[model samples]
Target: MKALILKRYGSLQNVMFEDISKPVIAPDEILVEIHAAGLNPIDYMIPKGIFKPILKFNMPATLGSDLAGVVVEVGSKVTRFKAGDKVFASIFDLGKGSLAEYAAVPEFAAALKPDNLSFAEAASVPMVGLTSWQALVVRAQTRAGHKVFIPAGSGGIGTFAIQLAQRLGATVGTTTSTSNMEWVRTLGADEVVDYKKQNFEDVMQGYDTVLGTVRGDALEKALRILKPKSKIVSLIGPPDGAFASRRGMNLLMRIVFSLLSRRIIRLAKQQDTHYSFLFVQPNGEHLAIIGSMLESGQIRPVIDRIFSFENAKLGLEYLETGRAKGKVVIELKDTTI
Candidate 1:
């Protein structure tokens, strides 16, 4: 089958289409005939070797993570799905990718795609969904009456997270361009800061949780917005010692992460807030719950565009420009090259 493969790390120039053997499933995995794939910021970042130290992929490896498709075959131990089942999944850290004719998905990380969502929309949910769930609900413990701040309301994670945070019953605040302020408000954000006109830290304050998505010193400024004892979970991170520990890195790597995050940790401590870095993990059960929300209309996908499978690199280029209002996706078919 023809698939997108990474020949080297550095730039998208390294990624191209090539013929590769179709995947053979393990006892706990299922083979999917991919129809669509989601492009997250991380998808572009990987070519720059951002996760080289963590994920183990061989040379000329396939490139992608989130996919929506039909199950063509199930593993011997798989019971949740069978041939011809519609499913969506995040294949991150699973030693495979979805920008291909087919991909092997672990049964534990695949969920029935919501009947209401097309394959393109379903493909767009995994990374952002898991990120929001792990950050707001699992780590920050956002609840009714809590004030939650999530910056970057126009981005993929931002759009989904705003809705999820509101559903979790937190008052959500977010930052976007002037044009998107009202757009984000429609997504349930209580406070929308037009970043071109207002510095968020100047006016926003007293939050119970902060989901850090923007890079640079924004996370630092966010500290002042939180009440004492609030929680901050950063997806864009100078990863902390805890993250390194969880990844089971060597002592040197843990020390390196500790050094890198020392200032942020110290600042959080002084402000009486807890700071932690989160790398979203794939979970089928959580996707099932998120799927229910999609089915019920409590949440809807915010898709900026859908590119053809052949134009995935162009889609990645467009997404990297930081202009997309929501998620970008790539659509394919069983007959696609």
Candidate 2:
């Protein structure tokens, strides 16, 4: 099967398109014939060695996380799906990814794709969808009447997060460029701050939760807007000891993360708010819930563009520009075996 393999950690030049043996499934896994793969920042960052310390992958690793496809085979212990099942999953285990003709996914991390979506649209959901679900519903415990602020409302995660927060009954506020303000409003953000024309911190305040996806002073600004005892969930930077412990990092790594997040953590405390980093994990059950939401039209996918499988490198380059309004996908021509 043809797959995108990284020979070494570096730039796009390290990504090689070549034939590789199809992965065999474990007892609790399923082999999926990938029809489409969603591109995320982590896909490029991994090959750039940005996450090397935390996520160690062998050379010649595949570089995708979200995928929608058909199940060609199921492991002996698999129960939720079988051959010919249409499914989507976020392969959270690094290195073992879906940017290929086929991928082996843990059964518990795969879910039936929504009937309303195409393979490309479904592929775009898993990573960003689950990130929003876990951060808002699971971590922040968002509820009706709560004020939720999400920065970068036009980006992959932000697009999904805004809708999900609104669905959960929170009043959503988000940041986007002036050109995207009206567009993101369609996603149900109650307040849209044009980052070019206005600062989010000045316009939105007293939030119950803030979902921070950007690096730099965005997290600092997010902290200032929260009401006392509010929570700020950051997807980028300054991962704290709690996150390190959750990932079961070594003592050395834990110490490193603790020291790294000390200042931000202290600042959050001083403002009478809590700050924690979120690393989205794979969970089939959560995907199932998201699938239902999609099926019922409670949430919709926003796709920026779809690239052919052969031009995946160009797709990654497009994603790196940080100009995309939503998820970028790579569509495969042959999914049937």
Candidate 3:
């Protein structure tokens, strides 16, 4: 099987194709024949060694996290799925990747693909869906009458977050280019900020929650938009101490993260707002619920482009450009190496 694998960290140029043996599953895993994969910002970051300290990988690691595939074999401990089941999963932080012809999926991370979606669409849901579900529903506790600000409203996380917030009855506010203002509004954003013409902090106020999708000063600026006792869930982060403690990092690393996030922490504290960083975790049950939402048309996959598996490098290149309006997918089954 040909797979795009990292030859070394520190550069995307190190990622290349190689024919390797198919993965052998453990008793608690399923062997999936991948048909499609979704590319995220993290996919490119991995090869750049951004997550090296925490997400350690063996040499030549496969380079993707999200995938939709058919199960060729199931583990003895897996009861929810059988051979030939169509499944989608985010195998992130799992020490393996999905950008290969085959992957070994743990039972806990595998969910049946929604009947209403194509393989590429199903592949696009897991990471973004999980991130939004955790940020808005689990962490922020967004509810009816609450106003939630989600930046990058037309991006992968933004598109899903807006719809999910609306489903939870929260009024949504988001930032997008002028062209995508109406696009995000249709995704359920009640307030749209044109980041070009106006700074959101200047115009949007009294929000109950802010899903911090953009990096740098955006999270701190978000503090201005929220009311006292509100929450900001940062997806892009100089990760906070809470995240460090949850991941069980060493004291040295925990201190490093603390120092990294101290300014935002103090700024959030000064405003009486709660700020915490989020790392999306994979859960099949959560994906199942999101899959149901996709099937019901409560939310839809926003795909910007689909590249043949042979052109996956181009897919990653395109994603790295940060110009895509939504998720970018790479199809595999009918594509050549």
Candidate 4:
């Protein structure tokens, strides 16, 4: 099997397209002939050793997090699905190996693909869908009539968040460039802030929750945009109380971050608001529910582009631009069932 393997942790140049042994299914797993795979920021970050401390990436890694495909063989314990069953899932929890012709995924982390979607569409659902679902529904307890603000509304998670938040009856507001303003409104955002032309913090106020996918000062600005006692969920790093001590960091830098985070933590306590730094978790059950919602027309997959398997590098480059309106996928050409 040919896979995009990372023999060393460095830049994207370290990634090599080479033949590797196909994965054998575990007793509780299923072998999937991957039809498409979705790219996420973590896919690139993990291989570059940037998340080395927290994510614990092993050398010679294969980098992909979400996939949609058909089950070629199911283990004896896999009663929910069998050969020829179509499925889609976040393979992030199973380890990063979805950037290949096949992957052996644990049965519980995979779900039946929605009947209404193509493989590319289904592949777009797993990681960002899980992120949107967890942040809006689980963590923030978004309910009907609630007001929510999601940043980067036309991007992968924002696209899903806008739809899911609206489905739960929350009046959603999102920030995007002028080019994507109408796009997000179609996704159900009640109001769209043109970030390039207007500052969202200046115009938008009083939100039950805010999902921030931005970094630097923009991330700090998101905290100010929320109402008192309201929640803010950050997908980027450096939020209050998110302490992950790295090994053998210079004492000076450690002390500086500790004091800075402590001050932010204190501020969060004073406002009576909660803060959470989110990394999505895997759940086949959640994907099944999302799939049902997709089939019902309550949600839709937002795909930016689909590249042929040989052009997977171009997919990664496009995602790196931070301007994709939605998920980008790499499509494979194996048609056998």
Best by lDDT: 1
Candidate 2 lDDT for residue 166:
92
Candidate 1: residue 267 Cα off by (Å): 0.3
Which lDDT value does model 2 have at 328?
Answer: 97
Error of 4 at 295 (Å): 1.0
Model 3 residue 209 CA deviation in Å:
0.8
What overall lDDT goes with each candidate model?
0.93, 0.91, 0.91, 0.82
lDDT of 2 by residue, 97-121 (tens): 7889999999989999998899999
As for candidate 3, its clashing pairs are: none
- Please give each candidate's TM-score: 0.98, 0.98, 0.98, 0.92
Global fold similarity of model 4 (TM-score): 0.92
Candidate 3 local lDDT, residue 21: 92
Candidate 2: residue pairs that collide = none
> What stretches of model 3 exceed 4 Å from their correct place?
334-337
TM-score of 2: 0.98
Worst 10 residues of 1 by lDDT: 328-337
Candidate 2 stretches greater than 4 Å from native: 334-337
Candidate 4 per-residue lDDT over residues 230-298, each given as its tens digit: 887777755233333433455565665456467545566576677666768888988898989999999
lDDT of 3 by residue, 1-337 (tens): 9899999987778998999999989989999999999999999988888888768898978899999999999988888899999999999999888889999999999899988898989998899999999888889888899999999998988988999999999989999999999989999999999999999999999899998889778987889899999998888887877788999999999999999999988998999998888999999989999999999999898999999888999999999999998899999984221
For 104-130, candidate 1 gives per-residue lDDT tens digits of 999999999999889999999999998
Any runs in candidate 4 off by more than 4 Å, and if so which?
239-263, 334-337
